[model samples]
Each structure stands twice: as C-alpha cells, then as structure tokens.
Target chain A: MMNIPEDISPWLAIPVVLLLIGGSLITLIGTLGLLRLPHFYQRIHGPAISITFGAGSFLLASMLYFTVLQQRLVIHELLITAFVMLTAPVTAMLLMRTAVYRDLRNGRQSPDLKPPTPPASGHATTAGANSPGLMEETRDRNPE
Target chain B: MKLLVEIALYFSQFCIVLAMLLCMLRLLKGPTAQDRVLALDTLWICAMLFALLLGISFASLVYFEWAMLIALTGFVSSVALAKFLMRGEIIE
Candidate 1:
C-alpha cells in the first residue's frame, strides 16, 4: 500500500502523518472502549470519538495529502465530514433511546438508566418498567 | 519526509485494522441489541477511515468515493435498525 507518489514536499507530509497516526490511535482507543467498557452507556461513548475526531482526522489527512499530491483543491472529503457530523448524533441518540426503552420493556435494570421525564398534566407515574404507558403501547404496535 | 509519511501510513493502517477487528468483536458479543447496533455504526466509521487510509497509501481517488458512499448509507441503516428496535417497526 506504499504507492504514495514522489515529489511531495516534506512540509505537506508532516501534518498528514501526525493527523493520520493520531487519528488512527484515537479510533483504536475508542473501539477498545466499545469492546471493553463494562456497560452499554459507557461503551456508547467510545464510538462517539471514533465517528467524530477519528474520522475527522482521517478525512482531513486525506484531503491534505491528496490536495498536495494532485496539485489542486480536493475538498470533497468535506461532504463526508458534514454527513458524519450531521448523522452521528442522531444515530447515537436513537440507539441510546432504543437501548433504554428496550431495557424498560424487558424490565432489565441498569444503574445507568435514568427515569424518563414525567409527562405533564397526567398520572405518568403509573407507568412502570414492565408495564408501559398507553401512549408507548400505542406507539409500538408490533408486539414481540 | 516521504519515508516518514510512508511509515506513518503503514502504522495508521495497522491501527485502524485493529480497531475494526475490535469493533467486530463487540458486534458479535455485545450484550444487547442496542449495543450491537452501536458497534455496527462504529464499524462503518472504522471501515470508512480505513478506506481513506487506503486511498492515501495507494494514491487512488476511487477509495474516496467508496468512503463517501459508505458514510452516506451507514447512518441510515444504523438509524433504521435502532428504529426497528425502538418502535418494533422500521417504517411504521
């Protein structure tokens, strides 16, 4: 995989190297966190770093390296950066929400799990972990 | 400097490959469905980064497009899976 072209300047290469190595290392740590962290919530944070800084640096390095090599601006990587940034949080939030609600549905207890906010102007306290509220039951129509 | 870049690229490639392996292990052994989905999301990101690294080492432009397409579709699948888990339906 060492097919990087010649004639590239040293100055352009240094930052690329630093960003590449640092980002890769960060991603490794984050993935380790996903695997080794004791809980789901803690494990979730691990990949956050991967999707953000890790991918960010890799794309940035790709941009810099290719821009220097091709002798023109190569900013298309930004589209990826933007997509990741925009979607990452939504994905993470939805996954966390799913995890929490599933645990509640199955009555799986976790100290990390926080109680949902009580609904306004209603007896929301009646909803227990195993017994979900009418609204929730209505929302999830397909029963397992 | 070329030598430094070469060495760094190799090392980074190795690291990302290792990271991808770790993510797969989590995907396989994650205690719950949500954990698995999260691992899948992370796996795609790792894969994308790996592609970018490959682009650098090979000096090819195709990997960049591959990375972009992966990035575009990965989030949708993750979100859809999570939605299915949450709502018991992907489209409803």
Candidate 2:
C-alpha cells in the first residue's frame, strides 16, 4: 500500500515492474510446490527454488529500483543474497539428513541407504537417538 | 508509468503475502518435523521478499537493512532448527 512518488520515470518503472511481478510469481510458485507436493523429498525442491531464483530476482529489483530513486548505487541488499546462498543449502542438507536418520531409527530402511557403520567411539548411538539426555548418554557410552 | 509501477508493486505485495500464507499452512499441518522446518524456512524467504517489495514501493533505503536483518536471523534459526532436529540437541 505504498503511494507512488510523482517523480519516478518510465525508464525506471519498466524493469522494476517486470522484475517485481516475476519475483513474486516465482515465490508463489515455489511455496505452492511446498504445500501441494506429496512427498517431503519433492517438497524440498520448492523452497530451494525460492531461495535461489526468487531471492535473486527480488534483490536485483530492489537494487535497480533504489539505485534509480536515489540516483546513486544502492547494492547493500546483495549481502542478503550472499548470506542466503551460503546458509540455505546447509540447512536443507541438515533437514534432509534428519529425515533420513529418523526414518532409519523407526526401522524404515530403504534399499538405497546402508545403515551407517557405527562411528568410532559411540558416535552413532547419541546421534541416532532423539533424546533430551543425549549428552549424558554419549558420555556414559564413551568412557575414554 | 507511475500508475503502472504502483499497481505492479501492489500486486507483487499481495502475491508475497499469499505465498507466506501458504507456507503457514504447511508449517501448521506438515506431517513430519522436517516438513515443518522446511515450511518455516520457506516462510522466511517469503518474508524477506516481502520486505524487498516494500522497499521498492516505498522508494526508501531503510527496508534493505530490515531485509538483511530478517535474512540473517532467519538463516540462523533455520540452521539451528535443522541441527536440533538432526543432533537431538542444539549445542552438541
């Protein structure tokens, strides 16, 4: 609900409009994928797309729009793009591993996953179990 | 041009909000912990985009910082949630 400024020119408006519309549509499509996809593995791809393409488009548009409005380069938003690019993959990997680990613990062994050979020094038990007292359990299991 | 940009910005804002709503639905009814976490992460992205859209419409520089802050905290939270789910503890 922003009031449009009287000074913004068509040259600036054209790309900004296109980029904004495109980014929002991309975001909507991605979130729809997250909601409608039947399987979690398939669902993961949805947010991954938003994180990359959607973020890129929005940030680029912001940079373009602001640079025009202020008549100076405004690119601080690029840092957000960098931060997202670095952190999203790590979080997605961890979540996927958690799902796989929970599946293994519940005895749903798929053919593709070999039960991880126990790490030296009781690593698997503590990591494999979802319990509050896991730190104590790890210590008790590993005496050296 | 002014009218066109204004309408585009409004439409974009609406789309991002709707996307956030969809993400909220996933977060509420997701079948598994990982599913909920993924939904939450997607919600964070939607929120960040919302902020960027706001910045464009308002023609201000401050929303950029807000977007950056949201991105930072969201990243930390998503990573922490994923780690907690994976390791059974946050710090260990």
Top candidate (TM-score): 1
Cα shift from native, residue A87, model 2 (Å): 1.3
lDDT over C-alpha atoms for residue A127 of model 1: 48
Writing each residue's lDDT as its tens digit, candidate 2 over B2-47 gives 8899888889989999999999999998877788999998888888
State the lDDT at A115 in candidate 1.
40
TM-score between model 1 and native: 0.85
Q: For candidate 1, write residues A10-97 as lDDT tens digits.
A: 8898899999989999999999999999888889899998888999998899899888888899999999999899999999899889
List where candidate 1 sits over 4 angstroms from the true fold: A113-144
Best candidate (score: lDDT): 1
Q: Would you give me the overall lDDT of model 1?
A: 0.84
Would you list the clashing residue pairs of candidate 1? none
Deviation in angstroms for B68 in model 1?
0.7
**Candidate 1 lDDT tens digits, B1-92:** 77888999889989998998998999888767788899999989988898898898899999989998898889889989999999889996
